[model samples]
Target: MTYLVTGGSKMGKSTWAEDLALELAKDGPVHYIATFKPVDAEDALVIARHKKARAGRNFAVTEKHQGLEAVVIPPGAVVMLEDLPNLLANEVFDDGDVSSILPGLKFLKALAEHFIIVTNEVGSDGTVYDALTGNYVEALSFLNRQAACLSDVVVEVVCGFPQMIKGDGP
Candidate 1:
């Protein structure tokens, strides 16, 4: 079961995805694939908060910021990808390309029986931006669409409430 959970920043998507993955992994191992590579103080703080939140949850944390294909996930593992936007950003900034993200997403889907992916909902506010920001938004939008199409369950979190856009509600 591939589930895609998307929302704006701080909208409870991560919390919901974590809870779902824990529930699904009651009988198996839960692999928490954290995509963010903390490069600044703020990033480190956010990562720390997430670590605290998942403390004692028995999640096998795999901090892979790039090369998702290299991550060795156990068979039939319940995997939760914390967020996709950071991964995209890393790829974009590192290589000035976002096309590689689609293949990575496919690899992750194939690696687990139950995959829970968290990503951001960009450009919904209709705000104009600079050239680079615009490119990032376009790329993220495309990736989100692809994920939603492939996902068995697609949820949009708004104001801490999950609105099911595809599949049955959990």
Candidate 2:
């Protein structure tokens, strides 16, 4: 089962995704792939908050800044990708590559029996962007669409509500 959870920031997508991962994991092992790499104090705070939330949750968390294809995940693991947008940023901006994201997704999708992916909702607000930001927005949209295609369940979180966008809900 692959679940793609998406929403704007602070919409409780991560919480809902965590619950769904626990439900799917049952007695099995659950791995969390944290893709956000902090660059400043605010980002550090965000990381801290996420750590606090996951504390004692039985999640074997790995901080992966980039290269999702290189992560060594156990077979049949119920894996939750903390989010996707940052991973795309890391791939394009940090690693100077964008071609591997989809193949990486396919690899993870095949390796894990249950995959819970969380991504952001963007390009919805009527705000024009500059070239770099515009390219990022376009790339992220591509990633989200590809993820939705690969997912068995696609959910959109709105104001903490998990609204089903595709497939069956938990």
Candidate 3:
């Protein structure tokens, strides 16, 4: 089962994805692939909060910012990719390109039995920004579209409620 859960910030996508991962983990181990690269105190605080929320969830956290091909998951392991925006940003800022994420996404699709991918909905604010920011948003939007197409199930979290857009509900 491959699920792509997406929404705006603080829309409860992560929580819903985590719960789905736990449910899928009943058949095997659960791997939490956290892609966020905290660069400041505020980011660190957010990361800490996520860690605390996931405590006692029986998840093995893998802090991977890139190179998803190198991640070796046991066969049939349920994997939760915390979010894709950070991953896209990392790739974009590191090499000024987001196409690098495609291969990694393919690798992940073949690696896990149940993959729960979390992403944020970009370009929803309708706010115009600088060229670089616009590029970032474009890349993120592309990534999200690719993810949704590849996913077996697609969900959008709005006001803490999940609205299924593709496949059967989890």
In TM-score terms, which candidate is top?
2
Better TM-score candidate (1, 2): 2
lDDT of 3 by residue, 78-115 (tens): 98887799988787777734666777887888878898
**TM-score, each model?**
0.95, 0.96, 0.95
Cα lDDT of candidate 1 equals 0.88
The lDDT values for all models are: 0.88, 0.90, 0.87
**Per-residue accuracy of model 1 over 8-114 as CA lDDT, tens digit each:** 89999988888889898986668999989888999999899989988888799999887777789877889988778988988888783466677877888887889
Q: For all candidates, what are the clash counts? A: 0, 0, 0
* 71-145 per-residue lDDT for model 2 (tens digits): 899899999998899898888778646888788889899999999999999999988999999999999998999
**TM-score: model 1 vs. ground truth:** 0.95
Clashing pairs in 3: none
Q: If the candidates were sorted by their lDDT against the true structure, best first, what order would they fall in?
A: 2, 1, 3
State the displacement of the C-alpha of residue 43, model 2, in Å, after optimal TM-score superposition.
Answer: 1.7
lDDT of 3 at 73: 84
**Range of the 10 consecutive residues with the lowest summed lDDT in candidate 1:** 96-105
In the order shown, what is each candidate's alpha-carbon RMSD? 1.3, 1.0, 1.4
Any runs in candidate 1 off by more than 4 Å, and if so which? Answer: none
